[model samples]
Target: MRKLDNNEDGNFNKKISNSPANKRINLRENPYVARIRDETESMRAYINYETAKEQVRRIDDAKDLCDEIKKMSEDLNSNFYSNLEISNSFGDIHLEDIPDGLRGSVKYIADNTGWSYLSVLLFVLLSIAAATRGRYIAKINDEWLEAITLYVIVCAESGNMKSNLLKLVMRPHESFENRKQAQHAEKLSKSNNVDIVIAREIALKQSQKNHGKDLVICKEALKTLANNVRHDRNMINDYCPVEEASALPRVFTEDTSFPKLYATMQDNGGGSTFASAEGNTFLHLVLASRSPLDIFTKAHGYEKFITETKRDGTKILQQPFLNIGIVVNPDIARQLYSNDRLGLHGLSPRFAVCFGGKQDEIVEDNSSKSDYNSYSEKIENLLEDNFTQEPSRKLIEIQFSPEAKEQLLIILKETEKEQNRTPKGQTHYRAYLRKIRGLVARIATILHIWGHAKPDNHFVSKNDVLIAKKIVYSISLHAEYAFSANGLSAYYDAQKILDWIKRHRHSFFTSTQVAKGIEKMKNDNIFPALDALEKLNIIRQLITPSKPRLCVVHKNFITSA
Candidate 1:
C-alpha cells in the first residue's frame, strides 16, 4: 500500500513473485522443507516403479504354478491312457471307466428315450469297431436290439454297466425293455440259463451295499432263469441210483407172489427190502417164525424195512398173539420195528391145518392146545429135516429119538477124548461142557415152553406129540455132539472153540451135523468156525429167514432126499 506495488495489488503482478534464484537459495537454507520436497518426489517415483515390478513378479509366479499343474495333469493323462491300452489289449472294456460313447449311449437309453442320438451314434461306432476288429457281431433281430438297448439303459442307470454286458454276452437270446421287464423275462428262462439273468438282475439291484429288495429280486430272477433252461429229459429210472430213488422200504402183501415181488424189486433196481422172502409180507414172515424183532433187524437193510407197515395192523410183537413171545434178538427187532411195530397186530393168522401133528385133535377140538401141538410137531420136523439136508433141499423128514440121541453121544464122547489128550484137557473139558450144557438148556427151555400141553384127547394128537418130542430130543443130541466135536470146551484152556471147530470139521463130524453145529455155535464166539464151515460147504446160512437158517453141505441131499 505504501509503494502501490503491482504485486500487492489484487494478485495481478507476476514480476513481484519470489524469484526462482531467491526461492532456491531460501529452500537450500531451510533444509526441512527442501528435504520434505525431495522425499515426496522420491516416494512418487518409487511407488510407480514398485507397482510395475510387482506386476512382473506376479506374472512370473502365476506362470510357475500353471506349469506345475500342467505337469500333474500330464501324468494323470498318461496313467489313464495306459489303463485304456491295457483294457483294449484284453478285448474287454473297463466297465468302471467305460468308453464315453458306450456310457453315453447306455445313460441316454436308460433315462431318456431309446431315440437318443448319442446312444445311436455310440451303437453305430461300437458295431463298426467290433467289425473292424474281426469280431462277429451277433445277428440280433429288431426285438433283440430293442431288448439289448433297454438292458443297456438299465445297466447304465444302475451303475453296473460291466456286469450287464457280461450277462448279455452269456445269454445272447435274452432281451428286455427295462430292468423290471428283464427281471420278469428272466423268470421264464430255463434253470441253466438263469445264471446270466440272475447276474444282470443283481447288478441292476446292487447299491452301495446289497439289501432286502435286491435279494428278493435276485432270487425271483434266478428261479425264473432255472425254469427257462431246465432239462426236459425224463428221469432215467434205469440209471437213477437205486439207493437214491425208490429206496423206500417195500411191504409185500400176502396176495403178492414171489415172482411179482421179485419183479417189483427188479423194477425198482433190485435191492434188499425189509419184507422177508419166507412170505409176501414182513409181518407174515415175522409171525410165521415168531422171530425176535431184534434178530430180524440184523439182515441187510432191515432198518429201512421196519419203516414200512403191512396192510394188516400187526407189527413184529404188538399183537396179542405176539405178546406172549420173547424176542431172541431185541436189538434187531427194535430196528425192524421202527415206528411200525404196532402195525403188525392187525395181520391175520397164517395158520393152515397140516397132516402129522395131532390131526384128529386139531380136527375135533380146533382149540388153541391142538394148534400148539400141531405147530410144535411141524417145527420139530422142520428143524430135524433142516439139520439133515443141505440148504438146497426142502426139509421133509424127522429123525427117530433113541438113534439120534445115541449118535450124538458118540460124537460128543469122541470129541471129549480128543480134547482131554491136550495139555489143558481138564480146563478145556469143563469149558466145553458148560457151553454144551448152556446150549442144551436154552434149546430145552425153548422147546418145553413151546410144547407144554397136548393137542387134545385125540390119539392122533398124542402120536404127533411123541413124534415132536423124539425129533426135538434128536436135535438136542446132535447139538451136543456138535459142541463136543468142535472142542467148544477149550475156552477154559485159553484155546478158542472156534479154532478147534475149524481144524476138525472134516475129521470128527458128519457134514450134516457140522452144518447144524455151526449154527448152534454162533451163540458163542464162533465166527471163524462158522465162516470156515460155510466155505467148506459143511453149512450154509439161508439169509432169507429172519434168523439165519442152517442147512447141510451136500447138494445131493437137497436134490434127491
Candidate 2:
C-alpha cells in the first residue's frame, strides 16, 4: 500500500462520488490510485444506502407508535369500564332479580340486542317511568311523591347498540303517541267544522238583523238566537276543548333545548322524558343554554319550573317530572360527573350511572317471544289504563307496605350514616348518599307498578324494596367510578408518564423525574398515574429508605422501549 496525499485523503469524504471535480481526477496515471478510488466510491454508496434504510425503519416505527397512541386514546375514551376496579367488582343483575312483569322483556331485549342485562333493566325501569310519569304518584311513609322518575347515564363504546336498546324499550310510548296523534287530528277536524257552523249561524243572524224592516222584532229574535248559539259553544268547549288538540301529548324527546323541553313537558301532561343514544351531544347542546342544569335539578325533585320565553311568553310547568336515560362514552361521562358546578348543584347526585360490558360478555338468548309479547301487552295495558286524551287527567296514588317502609327506614339510616362519614369537600359523595332514599323509593314504585295491573292503593312489598336496593347499589358502584376524577384523568396521566418512560428508555425512575419531565404533570397528578401504572404491572416502586424515591419499569415495558 502507498500513502495517499493529505489533501486527497481529507477532501475525499466531503466530495460526492458523482461530482465533476472527482470525475476529472487523473486516476489512470496510477493503477493504485484508480483501485483505491473505486473502493472508496463503493463504500460511500453502501453507507448512503444503509442510512436511507435506517430512516425508513424509523418512519415505520413512528407509524406503529402513532397507531398505538391512537388505540390507547380510543380505549381510554370508550372502554374505561374495563380498567375500572369498580366495574370489576360489580356482578351482573340476574334475570330473577328483575321485576316479574319486566323480566321476560329484559331477557328478550338483552338477547336480541346483545346488551348487558343490567343495561336492559335500567332502560326497562326508565321506560316504565316515562310511560307512567304523570299517571301514577307514590306515597311512602306519609311522604307524597310524584310519579316515579329517574336520571340515568349508560356509558359504552360506539357500536354497542344503545340506540336499538332505547328504541326497543320506548316502543310502547312510540306506539301510544302515534295512535294519539292520529286520534287528535281527527277530533280537531271535527271540532273545526263545529266552529265553522257556529260562525256561519252568527253571521246569518247579524245580516238578517241589518236588513230587517221591523228592527225591534228582528233585534229580539237575533238576541234569542245569539243566546242559544253561545250556550252550544259553551257546551262544546266544556266537552272537548280545542286546546287539547292544539298540540298532541308528547311522552318524550330524544333531544331538546331547555325552553323546548319545558314546552314539550307542558304539552305532555306535565311530565316528559329525555332519552338519547348520543348523550354527549345532547348534553353539550342543552348545557350551553342558560341554567339548564338548575331546571334539570328542579324537574328531578318534581318542583315547579316557571320560565319566560319570547315565543311562548310565561310558561309554568307545575310538578314538572323529567326522566332522563342516555347512553354515552366514558370521556363524556367523566366530563359531566367531574364538573364542579354539576356536582355541587345537585344534578349529578340525581343520576344512576352504569357502563357497558365487553362485547364477548353478552349472555345467551333463552327468552321466548311469548314472554316478550306478554311484557309488551302489559306496557300497552298500562298506557291504555293510565294515559288518557281527556282534558282533565288523574294520577293514581301508590303506597308502601309496612315491611317495605321498615326496609326504607333502614336504607335512610344507612344513607345518613354514609353521608355523615363523607369528607366535607366531597360534596358529590355526600349528596349522592343523601339522595339514595328517594331514589330507592322511586325504583320501588316503578317495580310495584310492574307486578300489579292496578298499582293504585296497593302497598309496595318488601321484596320490591330489596330488588330496588340491589339495583340501586349495583349502579351506585359504577356511579362512584364515574364521579371520581381519578378514573379517566388518572388513565391519561398514566399514558403520559408511560410514554415519557419509553421515550427516555428509563428502566428505573422516580416520581420527581416524571413530574419534572412531563408538561402539565403536577405533583397531585403524579401519584395517581403511578398507582395506575402499578395496577397494570407496567411499573413497580421500591420501599427501601433512600435519598430519592424510585420506581422500576417492568422488564416487558423496557424491552418494548
How well is each residue in 426-515 modelled by candidate 2, as lDDT tens digits?
778678887787888889989988877777757899998999999998887776666655555565577678779889998678778887
After superposition, candidate 2 runs with Cα above 4 Å error:
1-89, 143-146, 186-245, 309-311, 358-366, 388-393, 491-521, 538-561
Evaluate residue 3 in candidate 1 and report its C-alpha lDDT on the 0 to 100 scale.
70
Tens digit of lDDT per residue, candidate 1, span 32-64? 987898999999999999999999999997797
lDDT, candidates in the order shown: 0.29, 0.73
- Measured against the true structure, the TM-scores of the candidates, in listed sequence, are 0.16, 0.70
TM-score (C-alpha) between model 2 and the true structure? 0.70
Itemize residue pairs with steric clashes in candidate 2: none
**234: Cα error in model 1, Å:** 6.1
Error of 2 at 495 (Å): 6.6
